[model samples]
Target: MIELLQDAHFWVGVALVIFLGILGYAGVHKIAWKLLGERGLKVQAQLDEAGKLRAEAEALLVQIKAQREAAEKQAALMLETAKEDAIRLGAEAKVKLDEQIKRRAALAERKIATAQAQAEADVKAAAADLATQAAETVLAARIAGAKSDPLIDAAVKTLAQRLQ
Candidate 1:
């Protein structure tokens, strides 16, 4: 028993036991356990908040994707509508241009007819003037060659007036 009391290892064991008993009497272990539990609860709450934020982010991403798809569809529809309108307008323009060309051709034909009519009238007037001059020249020659009776002179004057 004296040897055991003198052993260094036994003294150390005794000292450790006494220190543990003091800590228990002072409630230090309970305080340490409570602090650890509180730390654990804080970490769990942080994890829950992170999970909620992640879920919200995922939902927002999905909603944004849906909106983008809708916008793309709308854009495509607008493009198609624009293309159809362009085709329709192009056809309309072509039709109008064709109509204008036909109108111009008809107008040209009318102008040509009017010009031909004017030319014909001018040619007839010129022919009539030439015939009148020829008749006047022949009558003058006849008058110079022969003495004219009053009755013959009257007839010639009437004929000249009629020719003119």
Candidate 2:
């Protein structure tokens, strides 16, 4: 072995092979394993964080859903209240309108009654005026022209008796 190492080419070849083996071990085994191990730990931590974030997101989603449901219920109640209020207002308006119409009708009926009474009084007045005029004319004719016509005189006497 000493004799073989004493040859320069043989020692150089051995040193080259040992150096390449050390280089391969450093590049492919020790340094690579350490780096890969660290990378794997980092990936696992990230996965755990992702799971926690997913849970938080789910909780937030549930809260949002509950809020939306509550809002919808409130909206429905508000809509129902509005409808009830509208109905009440409409009924009140109808009642008021009916009262106004009744008032108008009553006024019209009162006017009609007043007109009827006035017409009746007018008829009575006209009749009375005609009767008085006829009486005056007969009295004048008798006083002015009473020389003859006993029938006219008797008729006039009967009318005076009836009038009295």
Candidate 3:
């Protein structure tokens, strides 16, 4: 190792290393600052875009607040309208129910009147039938003891034929 260090090849290697270091520094570290100017331009553009976005966000916030208030007002109005509609509907239902009750009462009264008329007609028909049956029975009893059987049969047969 000490022999290599003392050799001329070692000095040549040192010279090459020094030249590469100078080349790297000169390329990477520029004094003209073109890269610095580009970085500054990029930063300025970002700041301008940020300022524009901040303004837009503030405008959006204002619009959102206005929309929220408008929506709240509309909801309140809708609720009020619904309440009024409910009240109106309830009143209408009451009116319709009252009308229905009156109609049903009238129909019931008519049915009751019809039933009474029918009952009176039935009673009259039953009374007439009873009178007819009673008259037939009384006339048959009066004629039964006085009449001869042959005379009665002849007379009854002739009367039945004539009636038919």
Candidate 4:
């Protein structure tokens, strides 16, 4: 036993035992365990925060998708309304154009009829003037060869005025 105590290996073993005894006496093991438990709790809290943020992001995404669908539906409705308005306006324009064309044609016909009536009246007046001149020439020739009577001369003057 005295030889084992004097050996270098036995002294190293004794030194290692004393070092471990000092660490145990100081409660280093309890401190290490407490630090590890605190680290695990911190990690768990971070994971819970991450999970809450993911849930919020998913909710926001769903709301955004719903809004997008509503916007698309509104856009389609507006487009359909615009198309209907265009078609209605086109129809109205066509009706107006047709009415204008009919009115113009009727006005043209009325103008042509008036012009023809005026022409007929002018022709009639010219025929009456020619007839009056021929009658005056025949009466003058006949009266110059006949005897001059006051009653006949007055009647001949009144006949020329009545013909005109």
TM-score for each of the candidates: 0.75, 0.61, 0.57, 0.75
Model 1, 15-68: lDDT tens digits are 999999999999999999999999999999999999999999999999999999
lDDT of 3 by residue, 1-164 (tens): 89988999898999999997897788855643779988999999999999999999999999999999999999999999999999999999999999999999999999999999999988987886676566555655767766657776566556544533
103 in model 1: Cα distance from truth in Å? 1.5
- Report the CA-based lDDT of candidate 4 relative to the real structure: 0.94
Per residue, candidate 2 scores C-alpha lDDT tens digits across 14-121 of 999999898887786777888999999999999999999999999999999999999999999999999999999999999999999999999999999999999998
Residue ranges of candidate 4 with Cα displaced over 4 Å: 1-25
Best by lDDT: 4
Task: Flag clash pairs in model 1.
Answer: none
Off by over 4 Å in 1: 1-14, 139-164
What are the Cα lDDT values of the candidates? Answer: 0.92, 0.88, 0.84, 0.94
Q: Which regions of candidate 2 are displaced past 4 Å?
A: 1-30, 145-164
